[model samples]
Target: MKSFSILLAATAASVLPVSAAVAAPAKNIVLVHGAYADGSGWRGVYDILVKDGYHVSIVSQPLTSLTDDIAATQRVLDKQTGPVVLVGHSYGGQIITDAGADPKVKALVYVAALQPDVGESVIGLAKTMELPNGDVEESADGFLSLASDKFVADFAADVPKDLAEFMKASQMPVAAIAFSEKTKVASWRSKPSYGIVATKDLALNANLERWMYKRAGAKITEIDASHVVFISQPRAVADVIEEAARAVK
Candidate 1:
């Protein structure tokens, strides 16, 4: 009987590794930032992911045009040696919705982002819903940016004032036409998706986030933060990203 027990223990030990392998998280994670912000904003989330053993890459795509942004994301995806969990925030959602179609991408996470379907433009969707704060402005040359005075209140109300001010000072002005360009693909339809809704978001209506995420059939998490949920709630955002990664085969 003792020998039989010892044999059972050995069998359990042998199965442990297979179980672990099956549950292992996806190794590669690519984070995409939206217009008016750069990849630097992903620092909080990136640090958390790296500490948790993820190989994370943040795409700093020039917000020049939809094609350019998508190309930039695809370039990053090409560098990964294995499957990737592609994540996007704000306008970056439109980017991932198109770029996530890459064969190497295993899943997608949208954080307070615009998930536009094929033939749909960000401008088109924004028209369907009214933002709580209309603090954004367009330049004479046709670039779009948030008004400096309203940046903290509109975009990063939950983050520290200093950081929000810096984000405002360093905001990337996306071409106005970028918002008018339509997406050619919607990857969430094919890939497993997770969504985070910032219930206190003012820049983009929180209700719009719920509608888009639900339409895409994304697993959703709602947090009481501003538009920059990834910055204000990095730990929670990382948790959802890791959840998406684990769901990947």
Candidate 2:
């Protein structure tokens, strides 16, 4: 009976650790891409998170209207069962600012993203910066395209040549009207926010990136890359996101 009791105590000790491990929380990561890009932009980051055992989802924004894009992101946020680390790039930051209001969203990560303030439109923000002339071409049909020549020189110079080319070719035409639409709510105001500033970004000037971070009161991480920080500095961007994920629990 003494030996059996000792074995039973050993079993309980072993089971306690396993039970605690199983009870620990799981992290969920949601990626939102900015204008002129699709959800595929998150391929590298998504793979990294998945390998680390994170539940991940990438939202495909229509790039049509602010309300529509926010609604699309909100739909994805709604499906998450636990705390979520919402990551947004460029224009996507704007989407998260509004869609990230849900109680489930534990943190927000902005990658060289726009952190617009209350009642601010893209036009209002861009007006303060000296964006290259003719960088964005507007069609008679009211769509906007990122000039191919500036794709690498302006937005993605630090990325590999092939990947930059691929990004250029895959650019989606965003409705011109979307830029005029202002954000009604800003989630960064309430949520724990993190910002990745791309120092060499030409599309959104480096100074603007700093401005956004300061305005949003986000914990800032700086990277010496172009506007597409995730493509040029994937690991660094992922690290910031992982930190945000860790903060949830």
How well does model 1 score by local distance difference test? Answer: 0.93
Task: TM-score for candidate 2, please give it.
Answer: 0.88
Per-candidate Cα lDDT values, in order, are 0.93, 0.86
Task: Residues 1-249, candidate 1: write the lDDT tens digits.
Answer: 999999999999999988886667688999999989999999999999999999999998999998999999999999998789999999999999999999989899999999888999998999899878888899999999999889999899999989988999999999988899999989998888998999999999999999999999999999999999999999999999999988887
Q: Looking at model 1, which ten-residue stretch has the lowest summed lDDT?
A: 17-26
TM-scores, all candidates, are 0.91, 0.88
Provide backbone clash counts, one per model: 0, 0
- Looking at candidate 2, the ten consecutive residues that score lowest on lDDT are 17-26
Candidate 2 differs from the real structure by a C-alpha RMSD in angstroms, to one decimal, of 4.0
